[model samples]
Target: MDRTPSFLQQHKQTFQRVGAVLLAILVWQVLAMAVGHQLLVPSPLSVLERLAGIWLEAGFWSTVWFTFRKIVAGFLLGLALGLGLGSLAGRFPLFEILFRPWAVMVKSVPVASFIVICLIWMSSARLSIFISFLMVLPIVYTNVLQSIRSVDRQMLEAVQIFRLPWAKRVLYLWLPQMKPYLISACSVGLGISWKAGIAAEIIGIPSGSIGQMFYDAKVYFNTTDLFTWTIIVVVVSVLFEKGFLALLKWLYGRLEKL
Candidate 1:
C-alpha cells in the first residue's frame, strides 16, 4: 500500500506559495527604499495602509459592486452560451461549421479593436460586460467541445450496449469526462474576463467603476492609491476564482451523487 503524506507534506504547496508572495513583497519594499521617492514607488507599507482605509472612501463599495456585477454577469452569460453552443457543435458537424467563422473572428480580433468598435455602438456602462463575455466565450466553447470530442469510444459503446438511461449516462460517463476540461476552461476564462472587463472600463472610463478608480489614480499620479487599488484588484480576482472553482467542484460532486 502507498504511504499517505504527512501534514507538512500535504500543506507544502500552500506554504511555498505564501513564502513566494512574502519574498516578492520584500523585494518591492527594497526597491521602493532604493528609489527614495514616494511618487516613483510607494513602499508596500504605505500601500497596505491605504488598503486598510480604502473601504471608508466615498463610493468604494458601490464602485466595487458596479464592476463586480457587470463582469460576473458577462462571465455567466458566456458560460451559458458556450456550453449550449459547444454541446450542439459537438453533436452536429453542421453546427460546428456554422459557428466556426464567428469563433475564429472573435479569437483573432484584438481586444482593443473590439473596444473601439463597441464604443461606436454602445455606451461605456455596458462595455465591460460585452468584453468579458467575448473573452470567455471562445475559451469555454473550445474546451467544452474538445472535451466532448475526446470522449472514449469504448466507454461510449459500453454505455450504448448497457442501454443506460440518459441521466445515468450523463452522471456516470459525460460528467466525469467533462469535469476537468470545464474546470480548466472556467479557471482560464475567469482570469481573462477580469482582465478584458477591466481594460474595457479603463478605456471607456465608466463612472463609479474600478477602472475609473485606476484612471483617477493615474491622472493624479498617486502611487500609493494606485498600488492599493492594484492589490485590491489582485485580491478580489484571486478570491473570486477560488470561490467559483470551489463552488463548481461542489456542484459536480452533488450531481455525481445524484
Candidate 2:
C-alpha cells in the first residue's frame, strides 16, 4: 500500500556522510603521499592498521575504562548539581544573584589555570573528574536556568488550577519545556567534558590513561600513534554522544506518554 522511496533513497544523509568521510580520507592519503614522511603525516591506511591492532595491546581497555569512568563521573556530577542549583536559582531571585558571580568566575577562568590549581589540591589520577565537571557545570546551569525561567506562566497557573500531582506536573508540564534545553546542554557539555578531561589527563599525565598514551606519543614523536589515538577519541566521543542523546529522547518520550 506504500509508494515510498527505496531504503537507500531514504538514507540520503547517511550516504552523504559516508561520501564526505571517504573524500576526507582520500585527501589525507594524497597529502601524506606529497609529504612522503610517515613520521610527519602517516597515511590513513597506516593509522587504520594501528587502530586495528591497538585494542590487542596490553592495558588498552583498562586505560580507556579509566578515562571513561572519570569523564562520566564528572559529567553526571555537573548535570546533577547544575539542575539542582538552576532550579533553586529559577525559584529565588536572591539565590540567583548570589550564585551569579561564582558562575561567571567559573565560566571565565581558563581551563589550564583551573587544572594547575586543582592539581595542587588533588592527585593527577583524579584531575580529569574535576576538569570535566568544571567545564560542564556552567553550560548545564545556564541552559537549565534559562529554560526554567522561560516556562509559560499560563501553563503553571493551569497546572495549579487542575491541582495535579507533583509528578504529573513535572511529567506533563515542566519536562516538555525543559527537554530541548536539557538536550542541548547535554550535547555540548558531553563534548566539552571529553575534551577538557583528556586535556587534563594529558597535562597531569596519569599513568595508564589514554591521555598518558597521547603524552607518550608526543614525547616519542609517534605521529601514527597520535593520529590513531585521536581517531579513537573522536569515535568514542561521537558514539557516547549519540547513545546518550538517544536514551534521553527515549526517556522523554516514555515520560510524555505517562
Candidate 3:
C-alpha cells in the first residue's frame, strides 16, 4: 500500500473552503445590493464579469507577466542575499552585530517610507524590484540567521566526531535542521514581496504594470476593474505561495528519504 502522504491532506477541507467562500460572496453581494452603488462596493457578478473582460484582453497577460517578473526577481535576489548574509551572521558575532541595525531598520520602517526614499535613488521602472527586495530581505535573513544559531550543538558534535563528509553534513545536518525556518522565511517573504511590489508599482505607476491598471481604475472610479484586479493579485499571490511551498516541501521529502 502506498501509505506515504504525498502531500498534506487538505482535500477533505476543500468542501468547507468552497462553502466558506460562497457564503462570503453571498454576504458581499447582499451588502453591495443594499449599498446600491457599484462605486462603493461592486457586486460579485459584476466583478467576475470584469475579470472575464480583462482576461479576454491581449494586454492582461502581459501586465501580469511584467509584475510577476519584477516581484520574482526581487524576491529571489533578497532570498539569495539573505541566505548568504544569514550564514555569515550566524557564524560570526561581529557579522551579526554589523547586520543587526540594518535588519532592524528594514523590519521597523514603514514600507511607504522606503518606497519614497528609494525613489531618490532609482527610477520608477525598477521600483517594484527594489521595494520587494527591501520588503523580503530582513525577514528571510532574520529567520535563517536565528535558525543557524539555534542548530543543535549535540548534532554538530556528533557530526564532527564522526567526521562525516561535507555532503552528508549539509544534507543530514543542515537541511533537516533548517527546513522549518527556511519554509517560514519563504512563506512570509513571498507575501511581503507581493504586497510591497504592488504598492510600489501603484505609487510609481510604471507603464504596463498591474498597479498602473489599478491607478487608472481609481482615476475613472471603475469599481469593477479595481475589484477585478485586486482579486487577481490575491489569487496569484496565493497560488504562487502554495506552489512554491509544495515544491520546497517535496524537495525536503526527497532529502529525508535519502
Indicate which candidate wins on TM-score: 2
TM-score of each: 0.92, 0.95, 0.93
Q: Residues 1-258, candidate 2, lDDT per residue (tens digit)?
A: 888999999999999999999999999999999999999999999999999999999899999999999999999999999988888898798989999998999999999999999999999999999999999998998998999899999998999999999988878877798899999999999999999999999999999898999999999999999999999888888899899999999999898777
- The residue ranges of model 2 lying beyond 4 angstroms of the native Cα positions read 1-8
**Range of the 10 consecutive residues with the lowest summed lDDT in candidate 3:** 3-12
Clashing pairs in model 3? Answer: none
Q: Which whole-number lDDT from 0 to 100 does residue 47 have in model 1?
A: 93
| Tens digit of per-residue lDDT, candidate 1, span 1-258 | 879998889999999999999999999999999999999999999998999999998999998899999999999899989988998898898999999999999999999999989999999999999999999999989988998999999999999999999989878998789899899999999999999999999999999999999999999999898888878877888899999999999999998777
Number of residue pairs clashing in candidate 2, backbone atoms closer than 3 angstroms, sequence gap of 3 or more or interchain = 0
The pairs that clash in candidate 2 are none
Assess the local accuracy of residue 24 in candidate 2 as a C-alpha lDDT between 0 and 100: 96
Better model by TM-score: candidate 2 vs candidate 3: 2
lDDT of each: 0.93, 0.93, 0.91
**How far is 131's C-alpha from truth in model 2 (Å)?**
0.7
Write model 3 residue lDDT over 1-258, tens digit each, in one string: 977654446465777798899999999999999999999999999998887788889899999999999998999899989988988898798999999999999999999999999888998879999999988888888988888889999999999999999989889987787799999999999999999999999999999999999999999999889899999999998999899899999999998887
